[model samples]
Target: MGIAGESVAVVGAGIGGLSLAYQLKKQGKPVTVFEAAAEAGGKIKTLHLDGFELDLGPVSCAETATLKQLLADLHLEQEVIAAKSAVSKRYIFSGGTIHAIEPSPLKLLMHPMLSWSGRLGLLRDVFIKPEAEQTHSDETVAQFVRRHFGEEAHQKLFNPVLNGIYAGDSEALSISSTLAMVKTLAGTYGSVIKGLRAEKGKLNMSRKIIGIKGGFIRVVEALQEELGADLHLATAVKKITPSENGVKLSLHTNEGEQERFFDKVYLALPSYACADLLADIDAQMASALKQIRYPKVWQIYCEAETSDQVFDGFGFLVPAMERKSLLGAICITNLFPDKAPAGKTLFALFCGGDRPYAFEPSVEQAVKEFHSILKPSLLKVLHVQEWSEAIPQFYVGHKKLLQSLKAWEARYPAIFFAGNYVSGVSLGDCVEYGLKINSEKGSVEVR
Candidate 1:
């Protein structure tokens, strides 16, 4: 036993699960992680194909202090490959032209594509106040943005960024679950910017986009290596039975099906998997988990010969209002030049999730559009990876589901749901939340 003679079991070996298990072990807790898949990374996998490296899952992470500290603790600080300056230059396709977002305040004011009204609306947000007695209650993202930044900023700026990240409609996604930081700022200081100012003084909350040197697969490997034999790849937790003493897991492995008892169980599984495993324990819990939605998404990988026509930037995002087959695209070479061959650039175009319909033709159209923008002497569409169930959508009422999870955790001792569906979906979010949840449980100390 690693901590106080307690045997801990973590189900699902994705980043969330792995990070949780890794931290528990670091804190002297004996933990075993079980994954249904043969590999441990989940979506954050790198595919080496055709002399190019492709990141199928999350392309980059927001290098928050939490993540930075974690990486340093894991001895992976030197492995971080900071994005090139181009990463800040994200393009947005609007009105038939791709415009780069200006970072400088002065430059942004004079940005030809940025509507003066949009900038004014954003400035107005600083002086704006919420409705009388407004609380941090559940509200749609669109509503929150529209109320604060006005329709122009919501459409041109906020919505396009959300399109690239969430793929779901801002009108449906919950502000509390999706943009909790800004929401808290608005609720506390009456303005997001004001809240940011107040919080930044209190803590070092700066963050940036980053990727591992080899790929996120390198991250998976590092985590897996750190876990060592404690991580049971291809071992599945078929069922979970919570008892008075602790919790029991019905495990299915290559050898045979066997039952194991643990002092506590942390489930870092997908909502769907959690639904199936918890059906017997509590139908209400399973029903709530099943209600969470994961729409289909497709990632199209293509390579092109470098040319003047090719833009040197992080690529473009098509606002949901634009009706483009492409939700967004990332220029792999710009971020990490080491991932591709010399004189060649790689592009990853995304489509489908939350889109009305995503088919081959749609993907083809996206490729054609990028082919035009990224004019190359030679263009080759290398691979198309389709994730049937991609990012989880946190709807307006997701708060209730979170509250229900909290309630269930309280009712059942030594049982916790620690999955993406329960918190923000970013890699940093999962890692930070995993640590915070367990830390609050009086198991491990959190800094």
Candidate 2:
């Protein structure tokens, strides 16, 4: 059946679902969003305490054209605020010392981040060629980094930086899927250095990171306001039955067992949840979905007694070779002053990606580990304001897995799987992809 004036049901109220709902509503389409959580934003959570705002999920985002266009369409262009341009200054632990790297290539040669011998070792990357062919293979991210840039780059550069972004394990993560763009660049120029320079405009063109004026939650709030009653909170979808023309979803809401029919249905829930929901629909798809693994990460927020001795710039990343359990830390206070009290600095500490066992530790133990690792210049005692899970692991065979998923989407022509687990993990990427999927040609039985 064709989908024109058909009803659409969106499961999950995360950025993807919210953005999709916003786009569908704009088109005057009857779209209803069902969220298991009481609030929207899904993983994009923000916490406020004593005039301080802590973004529990993604703290900042790049100023990409995709994000800019989305903001403009949502009438949120004016809400974008550029963080400190100097915030790009990064520190990495190498040979037992923290050193800052110059943001430019010329300064990179002069930068003390790596030894002369290590810099020479990096030259090998300029001459190395791609595999010259594409084959379906499962390789870890660390393996790819090591093969391309040597061990030092893997431990010191790639591990910490990638960890700070994804809260992921470099060794277990899939290189082809997570770093697809890097592979393309290397294949094109035959040198990452040359390719990065040529493709600078597209990759990090603006090179400036921006955040919402208030926080990421503001986007969710605005999206919810437009949705009004169509957005149902605490509504968990139980079962989905395929029909001749559409599909019927059995939802377990607070009221009672309600059956809703829609011509199109978007399953934007997490991988684990999505797998469970589609178990009976297609067993093979469910099995493949279950194979998608997720990492368990904990975010620790701390406040210094006085800002006088606090660290400057964004924060620092601890290399894996350092044998330190600490992944990295982001200075939230430095990024946004409005997020903390006047006299204190806020630190976003990340832990427990490879070490999920640490998640069972008591808060006191976690804080002890954090203070021992961070050892900020501040002498005053710090307190942990929050510690929560913010982990998402993308293991090997992810891209092929997503392709398999899209193939599975073919089985249920009208039921679409749209979520961070299937595509890009970034908030903007997920949301944008969700809206894009809605605009695609498809129809499934939902009644």
- Per-residue CA lDDT of model 2 for 1-447, tens digit only, reads 345577988999988888877777877778999998788988888777667777877888776666677788778988887887558667766665567765564566556776786566566667765553233255787776676667666776778867776767687777766777776776676667777888887875455688786789988888888899999999999888988777899998888899989987888888878888888887887887777666556677777543234466577777555545566777776777767778677777766555323334344554555565455555232334332334456778676777777666677666887777764777767766745653556421111
- Which 10 consecutive residues of model 2 have the lowest summed lDDT? 379-388
Question: Candidate 1 lDDT, tens digit per residue, 296-347?
Answer: 7889988877565767898888777677778888988998887788878888
lDDT of each: 0.79, 0.71
Candidate 1 residue pairs that clash: 2-28
**True-structure Cα RMSD, model 2:** 3.8
Query: Which numbered prediction scores highest in TM-score against the true structure?
Result: 1
The TM-scores of all predictions, comma-separated, are 0.90, 0.88
How displaced is residue 60 in candidate 2, in Å? 1.4
Cα-lDDT of candidate 2: 0.71
What are the C-alpha RMSDs, in order, of all predicted structures?
A: 3.1, 3.8
How many clashing residue pairs are found in candidate 2? Answer: 11
